[model samples]
Target chain A: MSGQQSTTSTSIGSRLLDWSLRGYVVLVFVFIFAPILFSVVFSFNSARFPTIPLESFTLHWYQTIWNDPDVWTAVRNSLIVSVCTALIATLLGFCTAYTDYRYNFRFKSAYLALVLLPPTIPLIIMALAMLAWFSKIGASGQLWSIIIAHSVLTAPFAMAIIRLRLNQMDRDLESAAWNLGASEWRTMREVIVPFCKPAIVSALFLTAAVSFDEFAISWFVSGLNKTVPVLILEIVQGNIDPQVNAIGTFVFLVSMTLVIVAQIFFTFRAGKSFS
Target chain B: MARTNFSGFATTWRMPIIVWQVLFFLGPLLFMIAMSFFLVKNYRMVEAFELKNWEKMLTRGYFWDSYILTFWLASLTTAVTSLLAFPASFALAFKVSPSVRRWALFFLIIPFFTSYLVRIFSWYVILAESGVVNALLAHIGLGPYTMLNTKFGTLVGYMTLTLPLVVVLQTFALANIDRNLVQAAHNLGCSPARAIYAVIVPLAKTGLIVAALFCFILSFGDFVSPYYLGGSKPPTLPILIIDTTKSGQQWPRAAVVAVVMMLTLISIAFAALALAYRKRASR
Candidate 1:
């Protein structure tokens, strides 16, 4: 529909558009990772302020956090909370997913909706509700309070991941196990669990990462039992410290490891299920 | 495997989780509502049904202003992030290879697992008056501008938080579209821009809208961006909730704000869900 000259002009224009799109994606990636890169790079900056012309690379800040007892306390608290939250959330998620897979009762839609509803609400409101409820029951300001809140926060995610795996599972495997005279418990342990192994592992890691990185709700309900993020917030509240960059670096590396591990397991299952 | 074991099986598997959600999730929500009506007698909540908390919070002009500001910032962030994410999503969905798409998704999703507080903090260094932006700008005699603790700073934080997520959601929705239609549009002498606006957007309208809705919901309820970055310039709703509790142990007043926020979110979610799924009239 175009003459040769016009076609060349359009092709050039389209080529320009293509390059810009690619460039835009690159810029986006740069923007997404810039703050992270800056924090990581400045963590070891011999200079105190996170400014340009960063001084010789040094581990002074990292060493500082290493010696800080408060930071250590936060690390311990976060570890216990994330690990406990992950296990509980995963177990609850598995049950919820299994319920969806195995049943077809009335109010099923409502049940599923409530299961997936937490992520949609803002964290501030949830934190408020959680804080009030915790206080009423004399459970506020404790490590377990954080765990309970985080489990509720993260279980839906675990349920979502496991539910996907359940949907992809071959229905016949379970029925076959049943026909072979395996008990329901036996079939669940042998057949369903194995099939969902990748998803379960992935969900555990993902939920752990989420609980580890979460801040607002943890801050409200964490009380004196501050997680790493809460500790970081206290440091950076009105002042700047290179210590935050060091702590941020540590938190960043840990969360990244958890998420990458989860991603690997998730994709491993995807490759298996599709092919 | 007994037929009569259905109830046992259902109860065994489902009841614990149902009870857990009801007790922890739903129970807290109900308590929050009730707590709003409880009397704050002698600086401690007492067992009384009163409207003082509601009256105190609702009658304040700052409360209403904060509510409006929160809504405005959230809506603005949604518009900005969605538009900003579109071109990258378009490229990822249509222009990139499968391997590239996979890598892009992985990279985009990484930020979500990282500390959002840190993400906002990263901007503080760059946007502050004596910060990196000004230092770089000194060469050209440009901005030593006031960027931090401003609306601009808050918007930047919101964008940083939502951009990666919106891009992931949009790319996912866009990638799932039927490509043949785009090819057909191309054959009918439509430009790439024209084809995207007319054909692709309508096909992916529901997903696009839902992604925007998520951006709005997250930004609306966010406390960190407005407090740390915006410097609480007349406090957004979430910031006000925090302040209320901090000032006088006004947990009841905070609960009132929380209830209002929840009601707003629920209604908005329902309306958006309806809008997303609404059918278009045929020509």
Candidate 2:
């Protein structure tokens, strides 16, 4: 009888623990995702005040965001910066990574560390330094200034990713191509580039995303021309518009799509590589 | 002939990379360090070196208070994030199926994709007086707490931004743990808690430390959360730097603060890297 009683109590305790753990997981999930869900819901809120109960669902806010010239300008600026940054960073990164992988050089580790340094430093410091540098050279607040700043900040990430890809590549293929009377450029273009294409693509998308979302460096370097983040800041500071929610929703959707696409590409490439 | 070919190819590519690094990376850093030593008089950086900016920045009571506040907030955020992430990571790593883990990983990536500012703004809507939390509080017959522009608000903002990173890193760490060790512990007649504590924890120590370091650095360097949420009492160091720069365009003061922050951050990173290396070497 005593054994039965003890077993019953032990089972109860275990059940309670299991329930508590489940509850903990649910609570954490809610905490992490609630704001995103809230943002999505409030975007459709017909009420002028974002904090108020939803009076009705309407597409008015979305229309407003679509029609806003400032929003378009910000988006345009973001795209231009991202595209330019992506191209420059990827090219530079490819060159650097290729050089590093193919050669045994002095201060290799130091060079790698140097590439990683900007990411390590506080963004504000980089922004301020760029601002000072640009001002001294009479190039502050220009679009080119922002582009250069973004490239400098993002090239390291591109290099790291591409270098990882390069390290894993079969060097024998390149040597064989070279032995087959292929020029160095031909070997790189035909043999190496195709192999490193996936990482290169990943680096491109990642750099674009990073440059698009960059605020601190953009904030300093963008003198007259504001990026989306800076524009969002201005709007928020000025007024809490339902339109801001619309804009936020749009950004969230676009960014989500980009990330999903990138992940799909990454996973597909990763699987292919593994197989 | 082969060696010379490789060397020739390397020389052609190497110079440009070197030039790029010197001009873009090292050059800016050296310039910033130099600016930190100069005197800024009447909104211009004077050529003469002066220690006044450093002394002023270091000696200010406000600077010390901000530093303390920033450190406390960062520590708090790291602790809270770790607490929330560890179990979720464990479940994802051990309990969930691979398909479910993939989905969970996708969900984890969502927060990162959203614009950072938008994420912060979303919190404002949730925590404001008229926000959902206060509405729920009111429904429960409790006082409606205004969370915006408060320290608590700042903490919440920081946690939301950084928790995903913690979860992802911890998941990566937990996934890498050897399964046989867990079974071995179980076969040895150890309780589940003891098995985890003795076997799994030791194996995951490096990952956990890395996650902690990542969280700490991210939180420490972040200025946006404090700016949007931290109201009248104290601002984070980055905000302070911005305010100082805006007032007089004091390059020296700004540079000093930047240098101090850089040194502190570098030291922390070095220490963490050393710990990681030591951990790896031990294995």
Q: Which candidate has the top score in DockQ?
A: 1
- Residues B159-264 of candidate 2 have per-residue lDDT tens digits of 8778887888888888899999898997898877897688877788788878877787777877778887766378788887777776668877888888887887
TM-score of chain A of each: 0.95, 0.87
* lDDT for each residue of candidate 1 in B102-168, tens digit (9 for 90 to 100): 9999999999989988877878887888778888998799978998888889998998889999999
Q: Write the per-residue lDDT of candidate 1 for residues A138-180, one digit (tens) a residue.
A: 8999999999989988999999889989998888888988999
Q: What TM-score goes with each of the models?
A: 0.97, 0.91
Please give the lDDT score at residue A137 for candidate 1: 91
Model 2 misplacement above 4 A:
A1-26, A273-275, B1-5, B11-17, B277-283
Fnat: each model in turn: 0.72, 0.44
Interface RMSD, in order shown: 1.1, 2.4
On lDDT, the candidate that comes out on top is 1
Which candidate achieves the best TM-score against the true structure?
Answer: 1
On the 0 to 100 scale, the lDDT of residue A243 in model 2 is: 77
